[model samples]
Target: MATQAVTNPVPVADLRRRPGRSASLRRIARKKPVGAIAAVICLLLILIAISADLLAPQGANQIDPLKNPRLLSPSLSHPFGTDNLFRDVFTRIVIGSRISLGVGFTAVFIGTVIGASLGIVSGYFRGKTDLVVSRAMEVVLGFPPLVLAIFILAIFNTSKGYSFRSFLLLSFAIGVIIAPTTARIVRGSALSIRNLQYVEAAESIGNTSFGIMRRHVLPNVVAPIIVIASIQIGNAILAEAALSFLGLGISDAYHPSWGTMLQEGRPVWLEAWWMSVIPGTAIAFAVLSFNLFGDALRDVLDPRLRQSS
Candidate 1:
């Protein structure tokens, strides 16, 4: 009689370790040094924004009555110099990070969630549903995003005074403007995923449309959504700045955003270059960081990109 051979059980620790997948920070850094650096800068900006209370020597509204000190060049005391209002440009710039970053993140969050949800429904249902969503998205896309954002924000600003609510309104407007693009991308991804065998299998097994979307469709499209969001944040930031510069956004009495700084400095540009230059530099740096990080993320997360590299 032949006896069946008993197999030894694999160690739990060994089972946990997947081959060819080293989860090391050093390895990640080596693969994308530029992205890593950009990420660090983004993290630093977040820290500065969070710690503005401690980092900024003056309050956001603190003013220097001294004419000589006002519009002075950058020095050890005031790294970003003073603005026309005698307000510490550095303090405003530091605190402004919170507002700018907040808008970017909040707007993106709103756009992605609403857009992805609609996209999933449209793609999964197809037929009339797809036609409706696609046409709506096209209408949204036809409008210049900046113009649409300004229009939406202006509508909200008519009766309401500036407050935290105003910021929310601005964020929401931007989010709505961004949503159509997000929805289009997500819809395309969902469409592809819907045709896959697993989705068909789920359908065969009598899985509900909602269940299939929640468990399958959503996950597949998340990567593109994230990539889209990262880039959109930069666009949102620029739009906010442009609106503020045009005097259509961000009242100075409430918050001194970088765009407000730019607007304020423009009148005194010849006298004190630092006023416009410093805040302008900050905006450029922030936008650059987002773009770089987004590109890096795409390279890392996209299987096609990774395979080509």
Candidate 2:
């Protein structure tokens, strides 16, 4: 008779507790220059957007019709110089941040709410409902957002009551344009989460469909949606600017928007470079900050990226 050595098996739980190479990669990514710079720029832009009134030297729309000189070049007194209307370029740029941030966040919020709800429902209760919803989303996504917006604006401008209604319409149209993309992203996330063991366990415990989704699914799927929403904020801001540039957004002449400033400055870009340059630069910086911040956030939050990094 021979004595055999017995060995204990490593528990699966214990095996899973060890940090892998991916964790080290994430630590490296957090220290990267791009990530650090992006974070700083994004933070600065957010602060400016929040405190525009306090930071702006003058009223955004105030015109110094008597003392203000058209095509005035940049100087110590007027850092960015005055526009054709003698409005302070610096002040308008600061105030424009409020409009850009407001439109971007509002539009993205509306799109995400509508899209996430539809996607969760469609993905969870798939079949005919999913097919129909998917088809509708595709159709909406097929149209060019800018062209669609132009058409909608033209129609609204010709309507009997063409007033403040235009602003609401523009916001809704921008939201609708972005909704399909959000829906697709949410649907993919929900589909993957729906088949997980925890979800199955909830189902076995007689949890209602809605309850299971609310309690187990939404919380798990929200991270990606949030990243997407943040990224979309920049896109919405750009879209609003494009619409206003073409004279389709915010019809009020007194309203001081970066896009409207660009429109006013375009004709005089060569002669009065500051007119377009200041506002254009503002738009560019704002959009770039949002994008960079979103990228960093996505890398930080994504499980695969986090693991690999």
Candidate 3:
């Protein structure tokens, strides 16, 4: 009799997953050059924001006529020139990053926590609970975010003025404004995960609703949360800048901001274009970076998108 020949079995799941991940990475690396460049730019901006104190020889709010000659163009001493108040534009831009990024992060964090909680609860428990939560979210979402934000700011800042406290209020307002949309997104993800086999198994095994949501639903929805955060932060940053430019946001002279910088430079466009252009460019790059990163992240994280690619 002839001896039987045997072959090694392939780990189908592992083989499929590994190559897909690698292919996705390579695709992102090769195809999305703009995203990669944007990521690098964001990293550099974040670093500059973090190390503003060390990097900026002049304080963000410090006005020095001797060193910062008024309306001076970009040069060695003051790289981004000087404003009308004879303040270093470079220093302002560096320091302003902290405010912009900080507000964006804080607002996004608050929105994520509240939105994810409502979404998970509403999604997991259908019927009355879902109806109530969904309706509430819809009501909130009906209003325009910028308009809502403006209303909230107007209400809060009427008596408080534009102090650090008011600054926090602005972030909170933006967070609340965006939470409904986030909740809707997370709820959709949770609704899908709620009916999955593993979730059913956990339910059969006496897993509490909270436990199921906390352990299974939240984890499954991480991709949406991340994508939302990336995109929302940029939007929030832009909104905050717009508010500041309109003299409704951070008006405290101590904290230098890109929007306020634009406000300052608006009158003297011809004399010192760098003053407005520099900060405007910073705002544009920051927003662009976040949007690019969000798109790249969505491509990587969404299985449907990966399959399509």
| Strongest candidate by TM-score | 1
Runs of candidate 3 with Cα error greater than 4 angstroms are 1-28, 158-164
* Model 3: per-residue Cα lDDT over 1-309, one tens digit each: 897766876778767765577776667878677777877777887888788889887887787788788889999988899888888888888888888887888888888889989998999998899999999988888888788888888887654335668767878988998898789999999999989999999999999999988898889999999988888878888887888898877656667778888888989998889989998998888998899888877876889997897
Predicted structure 3: lDDT: 0.84
Q: TM-score of every model? A: 0.90, 0.84, 0.88
Considering lDDT, which of the candidate structures 1 and 2 is the better prediction for this target?
1
Candidate 2's displacement at residue 43, Å, is: 2.7
Q: What overall lDDT goes with each candidate model?
A: 0.82, 0.80, 0.84
Model 3 earns a TM-score of 0.88
Model 1: lDDT of residue 279: 83
- Candidate 2 per-residue C-alpha lDDT over 1-309 given as tens digits, one digit per residue, 9 for 90 to 100: 998766987888998896678876566456565765766786787788799889988887687777557667998888888887787888887777766677777789888988998888878878897899899998887889888767766776654222456556777778888888899999998888888999999999899999987998889879989999978988999998898788776734445677888898988889998888788888888788788778877887898987887
What does the lDDT read for residue 114 in candidate 3?
90
Query: Which 10 consecutive residues of model 1 have the lowest summed lDDT?
Result: 154-163
